[model samples]
Target: MSEILARLAAVEEENRQLRQEVEALRRDHADHRETVGREIASDRRRITALETPAPALREKTAEDHVNRLFSEMRRLNIRQTTAKDAARLLGVSKPLIDKLKPYLATDPRFLILRDPHHKQRHLIRLAGT
Candidate 1:
């Protein structure tokens, strides 16, 4: 009976130690979660701060740049201009001028034409001019 009691006491002590370890683990988990949350919130704040100054720092909006391009197109004496010419004249990337196709389609003052002799070449021209 004394031996059984001693074994029971040892088991109880082991259980107590296990409970303490479990509690410590819980605390460590909570601390880790709190740290991660703080880091995520800090990242969100940093992203917002980086984004806030962009508009005021921009040289011009897309609309303003496109309007400037139209004005320049109007001032040209030539009846028609190629994409390369327009890109050179506007001092903008060819892809940027290419993006204007949908806008040009809707505008009354301009037309897009394909060259039959030189396949795949496109021209921009003043309508009825």
Candidate 2:
């Protein structure tokens, strides 16, 4: 009877230890899951940032095009040009010339004028010339 009771006590102690081990494993699993979730969220944010296009790059490219257009006009000694002629000189579409009108209008180096002979035509010229 004494031997049987000792054996039973040993079994109970082993069961308690197993339960503690299982609880520790659960806690470790929870921590691992939390860490993985945070990493996934961070990756998503990085992806979103990468996917968004940069507007500054487009604006810089447009500014370069405008500068090139001005250089070409100066090289050709063109004091003034119609939108169609400017588009042809710049090797760009007429709609692009229309888009550039705002930039030309705002710049102190350039002037925009309405054609007296043709109401539909606008003349772009170097300022003060």
Candidate 3:
């Protein structure tokens, strides 16, 4: 009977130790989760701050800059100029030529014509509306 009591006590102690370990693990997990949540919220706030436009930004947007360039080109009556040429005239990156091309392609000001007797190259001119 004494041996049986000793075994029962040992088993109870083991069970208690296991329960404490489990509780500790649960607490650690909860703390880790809270930390991760805080980090994610901080990242989200940082991203939001970056999303807002600066107060000292330019009045001329990319589209506006492109439009101004086109107006300058028409005023100068300079046709057959490549995208690089326009980019130079506008003092912007060359890649912006691709971005602005779509707007000017549909405009009536654009005239796609081949030079006389020369099918190897093409010239873009401004046709009168």
Candidate 4:
């Protein structure tokens, strides 16, 4: 009966060691999961930054929209139109049409004139059109 008691003590010690090992493994897995989550968050922020355009690039895109509006006007043979009308026809925002005012004023191929009937309105027209 002494040998049986010794064998039981050995088995209990082995079980305790195995429990400690399992707890250690669980802790390691939790740490790894936290590290991976942080990495994923950092990568998402990097991707968002890469996707956003700088202010200068955004202005360039708006200018491209203005150029497209000009092409559309020419194609449609529109001699004159209001800024609001142009915005509607081009499927762009009104602010973009407002931004085009300076370019149109300086292009020489186009003209900007005040609307006689509306004090706060203006007209854009192709030269000689």
lDDT per residue (tens digit) for residues 9-124 in model 2: 99999999999999999999999999999999999999999999643435665677678778888999999889999999978889778878888888777899998889899999
Tens-digit lDDT string for candidate 4 (7-51): 999999999999999999999999999999999999999999999
Strongest candidate by lDDT:
2
lDDT of each prediction vs. the true structure? 0.77, 0.87, 0.71, 0.85
Better of 2 and 4 by TM-score: 2
Error of 2 at 67 (Å): 1.0
- Candidate 3, residues 1-129, lDDT tens digits: the string is 999999999999999999999999999999999999999999999999999865542335645765676688778877556666777888887666556555556656666555676765444456663
- Residue-pair clashes per prediction, in order, are 0, 0, 0, 0
CA displacement after TM-score superposition, residue 92 of candidate 2 (Å): 0.5
Query: Using lDDT as the measure, what is the rank order of every candidate, best first?
Result: 2, 4, 1, 3
For model 1, residues 1-129, the per-residue Cα lDDT tens digits are 999999999999999999999999999999999999999999999999988853331224445655666678777676778877877887887776676666666677778899666798888887878
Each prediction's TM-score against the native?
A: 0.50, 0.53, 0.52, 0.51
Better candidate by lDDT, 1 or 3: 1
Ordered list by TM-score, greatest first: 2, 3, 4, 1
Model 3 spans with C-alpha error above 4 angstroms: 31-67, 71-77, 112-125
